[model samples]
Target: MVDTTLEGLSAVGDTTTGFDHPGLLYHDRDDYLGGARAFARAAVAAGGPVLVAVPGSNLAALRDALSDLGDAVHYADMAVAGRNPGRIIPGVLLAFAAAHPGRRVSIIGEPVWPGRTAMEYPACGQHEALINAVFAGRDAAILCPYDAALLDQDRIDDVWRTHPWMIGADGRRPSPWFAGAFAAADRFNRPLPPVPSAAATLPYVVIAELSRVRAFTAGQARSAGLTVDQTEDLIVAVNELAENTIRHTPAGGTVSFWTEPGHLVCQVDDAGHLVNPLAGRIPPAVTSEGGRGLLLVNQLCDLVRIHTRPTGTTIRMHMTLTP
Candidate 1:
């Protein structure tokens, strides 16, 4: 058994006093996934329940890989469940931690991509806040798997600094309070596949022009092997975003559709400046009316990015398309 001792614990990022873990921090996805699989084995062998909260996009693979784990695991779609930890990460952590009485619970996170950086959208700021909030005062370890392409390492380390018993990717064992969580770090140091690219673009663009955002998205959906119901969902998501460009802009905008490895992307670029940061998406509480368009966009797409400057706001919305 991997011993849990501060002397064995290695720190990666800056360390703080209040609430942080001291464990390994991995930059590679393969390493992270491998670590997760190893930790799961250890957790199950120890005879405790494993709670996994994954992004909607990652559900299929995660389930397939861990399916044999049986009833020992309970799964949830964190985004669909509206369990956003960034906004209220602390509360989310507390609630989950309380739900599992004595059994060790592992928190798994796979948030949206192109996350807000200090330079871009500040809204993505709470990654660590969510982790700290959930693990605060609790003994459970946390595993945060984010898209490194989108988030900066500086910001990630800033969040890692908060946990006292945490382990980064450097093979350190933090305080035992953070040991299980650190063990999570230790288990994740493996290999990953190369980043997958999108499919061809020529035929994809031709289809988008021939149809409205609705039809275009629908056609692509079918071609991408999506179910009829799934096609409808993708259509609704794309239509709203496409319509936003046509309706809210001065002249008009261009909508281009394409397919990546696991996502169907709809990009709308208009001549209008998005003076307001909160232009498109709205919260769910005000669902009495029809203003929750972008809000739906946020929930439906695996990733959503809006680049607005003096030029215009380029909305890149990605929907997961898988078999």
Candidate 2:
């Protein structure tokens, strides 16, 4: 219905347009390759920057197809770069778009794959939904491509709601399946599962107590067999989450850490409501006065789960343990 044209996007910068820019491009192998190549090449031909963030395999395929276009196309491994959906916006989408502010930038972001862990699927779903709000009226176009063969029908159903437009074999059209996108995102908002009984749990009442909490946690994490790098990441996440507690009343908060079969988890609880569901997920601008801490936490951890309410906010930061 809008500028969903992969062959060309000359109308991308037009302020007066119908429908919206974020569209769903669900495809199989052949369609994905052909459509993605055309999408990137078209952006280049129209003098707009194109960012392609997909898994490693797709990155390689698109690189080969668009290598001739020079710097018009940029690529990132979504598996690694977007492992944390919270980081996908500020880290991947906006970073590319901001670099070319004068023109309408195009992004092809593949967030969900067949192999995404169950623990990760919820946040990914929320991230896709939040994308609609993050760029609702901006001079940018994003086409989220879902793998039809790899993902189940239920997931394909979600793609229709998260994205307002669709690119099919018949060309682009407004998605009849789209709904109130942000409200749909709230369906995925949920509290993380309780910490395991084996988890090492502690409570700290004041900032002075945080140092002791950290020392205790470092020892426990190291004993739990966290690698040096993983340990550092865990500590950073812990410190940032703890720092947020300074704004709370003297009621204090709780901290928990544990090691699963092949993962390390650190969780923090505080009496603060996270009103903005989009907070931290979107990177703060260069001039942003605050809000960098949680963004850093998401980048350091392999996966993060959060549940916030009027009562409080609890966040779980996960790190993969190497054998």
Candidate 3:
């Protein structure tokens, strides 16, 4: 009998016939490395390999910890590989499937700085959607520590539905770039272009020219074959950031989006110094009716990179689109 009432809990029937229930394990208590080792052993014992994804710093640690498992463990560095989660996660799954044929593989997400809620970064809507699409039909498990404050019940459900198992390392603190780096590693051989730059001649502030920028973004998405939903999400992120340029800059800014193999890169350039240090990040308090624009942008974009100078501020965001 299965415990139907437990939150995020379900029993997976025998795999010999077919996986009865999608296996999901939600344990929020354990040491990350220790849990990883145990999981690796189990996967190997079950005639499958363990794929460990982590930052470069943790590579040595993971290798040493899982040394006992010998050929059962495969290590991949998400950071050194360039941190593209879309490619890495699915690539890892495909590799495992090829090697084991019928057996399921386990994924160990040993994120650095795992348990701190303050480290949680907002994932762009497109990026999250892309991840879901990649893991669409695979039997795998992702283990990491839980941040109760950073994750809500609904978000947990989303994770469970996407990942068969979620083990929470109680005291561990995982890094924010966990999934991003993994994706990058999977496509390491490809040359990732530097984020696009605009010419100095590009007008800093010209509200009349907004259409040109928006058109360029849409064109880029279309050329890249991004889904309508992903393109729209990216567009929303662009609009919010562009509006910020108008509101904050004395001179307007340039907004641009470019296509990568599996990403939509966007930038808003403004000739204004954000006098407010927390300009694009901090949302307005509930009692306050205004100031939520940039906050909303932050929530919508996967990653936000800010560059400010005497001339202006340039905000860069990345949204992953299905390939």
lDDT of candidate 3 vs native? 0.49
The lDDT for every candidate, in the order shown, is 0.51, 0.76, 0.49
Q: Which of the two candidates, 1 or 2, achieves a greater lDDT against the reference?
A: 2
Q: TM-score for each prediction?
A: 0.45, 0.89, 0.41
lDDT of 3 by residue, 122-203 (tens): 2211223234334446565544333333456654443433333333422222233335422422222221234456412233
What are the runs in model 1 whose C-alpha is more than 4 Å off? Answer: 1-211, 261-263, 272-282, 287-291, 320-323
Worst 10 residues of 2 by lDDT: 10-19
Query: Best candidate per lDDT, number?
Result: 2
Per-residue lDDT, model 3, residue 259, is 57
Model 2 lDDT, residue 82, Cα? 95
RMSD (Å) per prediction = 11.0, 3.2, 15.5
Q: Which stretches of candidate 2 lie over 4 Å from their true place?
A: 1-27, 285-289
